[model samples]
Target: MSKRFSKIAAGIMMMAILVAITFTPVKAQDDNQNADLWQVYETTFKSAKYVDLTHAFSPTIAVWPGFGNATFRATTAGADLPGYINEGETYTYADHGFIATAYELPTDQYGTQLDPPGHWNEYGATISDLPATYAIRPLVVVDVHEQVAADPGYHATVADIEAWEAEHGRIPEGSVVMIRSDWHKRWSEVERFNQKPFPGVSLPALQFLHLERNILFHGHEPLDTDTTPTLEGEYWLLHNNYAQAEGVANLDQVPEAGALVAIGFAKPEGGTGGYARYIAICPPDWPNGVSVVEVPGAPLPVQPYPLRRDENGVLRPTPPES
Candidate 1:
């Protein structure tokens, strides 16, 4: 038989072993479990679909300037290339094929990552300090794709936020307002991803979202809160003010509103930021429908929208102080 055929056969044999080893866990039922509770748990998400808003982490994934790359090195494999197995050991027929990989996780902020308050402020909240419930909250996507397509160095201004509110009805409090710049499409190649200056939140726009609207956090398709050109010595936007999710993808697929976003990641101690699994849990009948009126549990009182709306039903900006 040809060497290629032998390698394929070895791969199939190894896969079968891996499948058996990765069986689902069988956890015991809870003490106060009712049949309805079990049924509800089982059926609640039976028809739900999630949108992957995260970039797959890899050595090929785009890296921020002055950062390292994530890598995975196969330690052992079915193919008899170099050191497939022990020098004298031969392939086994049973489900015990030895295979492993050595990995470099890059920095915590590699690929798609979330920046908590502490990333900027010395005494600010870390990933662990953030409330567990904040992981899953409302999503408000404001598309700036067209504007950025026209001008590579665009900065989403306060007018952009106001315009979004005009249609979406005053971005409700505790929402994660994402600036959809469609930047992720170029993430495969570092050169293309960094080709232009890229868009970012203008100071007033950020102040509107964080201070006036009281959102949970802000997010973007780009790698940082500040535009590439403006990401200079002092990271003003990221320092101790707004939490952020950077290098996110697929925002173009998710709707502008009426969706719940779930961000999952391991909370590393003293972490500035880390890779996150960003998911958009949209309504089953979304795009055709609107945002949920109220979140199930007593609408999270994180930061209720304090500003009032205008005669046109838009959120009026906080008046400039004398």
Candidate 2:
């Protein structure tokens, strides 16, 4: 025995260097556990619970069609003044300076003498009096022209959102897929919610939710979400493709997918959609008592309210009394 075969070849070279230092730290801890399972599935679906589309801008809201001509008044007593307020009492700040007005319903007899009534056209062509920084985002009403008037041109596609993501599973990328169509309960008589022709989202469902599901936003429920005499008669699909960059019109109080939406844009610095105040955050684990005629299915015909059960049972949001 040549010294017992050199002590079994030095014990098989120290067990092959301890199996290469134990699989090099088990392949770097299996790639940090697959990047921590996609960071815990994007932090548990973005802390799940927030679904409010948006829609509330009163003065009998509802707009679109050269958009404008809604007013709110209360001015007199020293009327319209923008000076004298260093110490007040100039008729108590002109008797409570309350001047709210909007216009654009002009297009005939020389545009109604260039919009009379205390004279103030501010540029006047109307698209809802243009300047709220160009209405960039906030007006979420999400669908309701009497439930799409029996589906004439019936919008909402991408194979209806891939059949709602193969029956509710995918749709979670920044999520804001509102489309309620409750055309603001007929926006208080504006030729039946702005010159008829409601129902939205067509254009291959707005380029399949803005270029194949990158959806960070999208909105509907009248007030223009692209489907009027648009696309050629004035090209306006939220100002034609920023891919609905921050779109939202009047989502009649959102509820087609749970709820939680909060917009408050008054940015005004390069502006393009200012004056926003849209909130909706309900989630105590929702499902409280449930009533709104027992929300099962086939009753989402747009929503302007109808989902009762309060006495601590929860399921709130009830606004339909018109």
Candidate 3:
């Protein structure tokens, strides 16, 4: 075989092996026993690196202008509960021995989100209708940061996907493909982050990933899919009963291939959008994330200062000392 053909063949074989290792559960010695998955947890997962891809949402994070900012306040007692506290009284840690927060979220489309089809289509599946199989999938990160750097409004194209395949082989079926633009670095700077010319994914790229490769879904760093006059890319995705992720962060820390994405979301019944969390599980030697073995996490670390409500009503460490 030609050298190029031989290289391509090897790449394909490696991807197939990676897919098998990721999805297929190990068999147990005894068929009736439930130790198979336990073994996988003890062996594979324990040694893998984990990267958080979700951005924590708060009142300050940028949102679509149409959707107003969210509010956070201490949860108050209700009259009908028949408790010691009266209605409209705020609960406090000193008096009630516990404190709770109440969030006044204006929309489900806030922050990192999984946009279900129902967000646009009348007969499409809502957040709660998503299947359990959506829990985990192979992760593919197509880096377009250089293009985005040259052109802030750059939208990834089918050629980008083809180029990625040229190096990483075919994107796995049922995988979650994240378009990496490094736009998320601007997340803290709300105005700049939401400006007119942010990085995005083109409609053709989205179609290729879903129609040709059959990826579970495509995610991007920007909230919207493209900077087209009509946002046709996002419109086409949702109206066609396909879901996509937005406001995803930390793509630079993950590999181009050979990683798994753990998908999680708040399942509000019949909800149009999802408050989503995506975590990337990478190979142990990737060099940027914490491994399960590195941080067992059974007993989480405690902050030096106690949590107290801030001026914005969000809980923050008191005194703000480093």
Backbone clashes, each candidate: 1, 30, 0
lDDT of 1 by residue, 1-322 (tens): 3454344335434433444433433332332233333343333323334678988776666676677776665443445455445543433334245434456775787878888778777877787776787767778899899998998678788899988877666887988888998888888768768555877767677777888999887888777666545563125555735678888899998877666688897788878886788888664443432233333335645444334334423333455455
Better of 1 and 3 by lDDT: 3
lDDT of 1: 0.67
> Compared with the true structure, what per-residue lDDT tens digits does model 3 show for residues 53-85?
999998889998899889998999767346568
The whole-model C-alpha lDDT of candidate 3 against the native structure comes to: 0.87
Using TM-score as the measure, which candidate wins? 3
194-278 in candidate 2: lDDT tens per residue? 4546556767766666566656456554544455564431133333333231224335433334344554444323333333444
lDDT of each: 0.67, 0.41, 0.87
* Among all candidates shown, the one with the greatest lDDT: 3
In the order shown, what is each candidate's alpha-carbon RMSD? 20.9, 25.2, 4.2
Residue 65 Cα positional deviation in candidate 2, in Å, after optimal superposition: 4.4
Cand. 2 Cα-lDDT: 0.41
Worst 10 residues of 3 by lDDT: 26-35
Pairwise TM-score winner, candidates 2 and 3: 3
